[model samples]
Target: MRKLQFIILLQFSILLFAQENEMKWQEKQYPDSLEAVNKAPENHIILFENENLRLLKIFVAAQKSEPIHSHRWPAVMWVYQPSDYEQVFYTENEKAERIPVQTVAMKKNELPMNVGFPVGKGDLGLSKNLGNQDLVAYRLDFKKKIDSSKKITKPTGWTWNEDLDGVKKAPASHQIVFEDEYTRILHVVLSKGEEESVHTHQNPCLFWVVKSQPIEYSEFKMDKKGKLRKSKTHQLPPLPTDQLLDQNKISDPEPPHSVKNLGTENFEAYRIEFKK
Candidate 1:
């Protein structure tokens, strides 16, 4: 009887190990159907998608939860509106593993809660919001393997209050929200009568307007050194709020220029860039 019981236990252990390995996301093992947008459409809104990236807007109201879903790729999540929440990860045998409650809050004057998620087993699950406030965030998924050889070493002066990046030569208005081997998230805000220093994107960037009004005024044109062609300012009509602004080419970057806000509302957006 003792030997039989031992054999049964060994079989169970082997099954658990196999299931754990099977759940890992791999280039050949996973399918697009398991993505959060496809599995939990109500809370995960797909804004834009391509072979390299997928931009999603996540919204979970207070006292609510998102359905079980999987994010098969590595990602960086920029949370503009945050709330306290708990995480529940499903196991291979359909058991629940509940993570401790985490509190997240965002302030208007301050930056949002920036997070980086690594590729893991596909046993992903829902996030239950414990706070009364709604949890809204933008998630950018890296659909392909990000080259580690192209990682950007943190510049000598990278800081929360000041950004020494060549692309963000202006004051603290434009800054890096988070940076990892996989992705870089930037935040830019320009108030009325304010202008950004002459700079250009070093990488292909996907931009999304976070806060703005239809009537807000802005313009981006060529600039020489610190000088602007006074009348040559080509006005850029503000895109509607919560919309993804598309850009072309992964190999191509934006030309160096400056932006002067000429409206009452502040110009705000998140820019997701890649090193490779």
Candidate 2:
């Protein structure tokens, strides 16, 4: 009876060891299914997606470290275990470089998060080398889908206190028509021989000519590196009212300049600037 009991205990120990070793891997696996291959003993939380910008999350127990593999997507990661020390290395145009060191120390037990922009197609492989202890992390992938409609409805700017006018006039000249907290969006209307009131943007802005008949225009402009600098003006030919304004045609840093309509009918345009 004693011998049989000892044999049973030994068998149990062997099975547990085998299970632990099976969890460790040093090679990558290319599974056909579009899902994360997780085997670590730690609490793994993964957010991944396919060709579309949809998101996913996964968690699993893990043991030993695994060999790295290629992951080509914009991602944000949070390291939940071990020391807060984290790092990323990559290749750009065939040249390899490790991301800048995050000197900021993480709180004890606090998760570390990282956001990666688009990377070169040639960049390949990612791995996490753990120390003596088990590894744990939570990765969040943000792959926002591009909306073409946003391209059309992108706001230009806000209407300023002075942009609204008490008088009605139509001709070809320069004018200041709109202002708002949003720096990148602008709504400006132009009339012949009109002059804009002196003002300052303090930030970048855009212009879209919505309506222009015989639409001669002044070049848009912005101040120099210095703030409160006066804006200079440039003259431009009239744009047709039937066509949509092409944003790419205008030069940037186009601010502070006054507009002058050089046409028989009124000219209207919108501008949008990006924020930091």
Candidate 3:
């Protein structure tokens, strides 16, 4: 009877340990928690966090798995390196299931191969890298809940013509990755010494540097013959600013500008424009 009782106690201990490991994130009791990222900085690094949003850089090595975590905000994820992975979601009842997340390449002028998902409050999941290369990505989580009923306002002093001549043409390096009523995300890649076409950003915008490199920012001025000419250039830093820019903060109405890569390697970035 003593040996049987000891065996039962050992089994109960194993069950308790398993339960503790599985529901580590749910026990925290906070919907807006980032405990997993706090615990593992190597895999999940917070680049910037403010009242409006939180930006994170995440890297998962090949064949590795991340701890179960929870996200309570709507997020936009930009993929730098594509890799196969499986995402396992946990429920309130401790039930779990794995779902395959595949990477699909987009068209040249369309959105990049990334993900934009609305993670309802207290959503919990874990991801496992199944490919040989590391999975690298940037996540932008909006702190405030979005209201879909509200319409995004257009930029002042500018019309909504997409085919305007002179400053409205997008450069070859610019690709629209993801867009919604509130925002538009662009993926831009410029080779060394390459210059983008003159363009105008009517709305407020911010960009994230995926490949850090020097770049020159220049404005377009109308010449005597009604042609656009590049003005004096200003050197932008190799890194992007963590803060978001809105219409009230940006300089000049109907600003027309272009970018030139100043580094030896390719300059890669994600431009996020606020529509409202």
For candidate 1, write residues 30-55 as lDDT tens digits: 34675688888989987778897787
Tell me, what's the RMSD of every candidate? 11.8, 23.2, 13.3
In candidate 2, how many Å is residue 119 off? 31
Highest TM-score against the true fold, candidate: 1
Compared with the true structure, what per-residue lDDT tens digits does model 2 show for residues 1-276?
Answer: 765464445345434432332333112232322123343213333222334332222222232333332333333232323443222322223233333211222323442222111222112233343343444443333245344344323225632332322111212222322222322333356566666544433333333444664432233333475334343445566664323344433233332334556666566654433233
TM-score of each: 0.67, 0.27, 0.66
Question: For model 1, where is the 10-residue window of minimal lDDT?
Answer: 100-109
Tell me model 1's lDDT, rounded to 2 decimals.
0.61
Against the true structure, candidate 2 reaches a TM-score of 0.27
Worst 10 residues of 3 by lDDT: 100-109
Using lDDT as the yardstick, the better of models 1 and 3 is 3
lDDT of 3 by residue, 106-218 (tens): 22223225533333344456767877778787777888866777654554556534553222486578776667788777777899999887777655566556776788989
Residue 251 displacement (Å), model 2: 5.9
Query: Per-model C-alpha lDDT, please?
Result: 0.61, 0.35, 0.62
After TM-score superposition, the amount by which residue 249's alpha carbon in candidate 1 deviates from its true location, in angstroms, is 7.5
For model 3, state the Cα shift of residue 263 in Å. Answer: 3.5
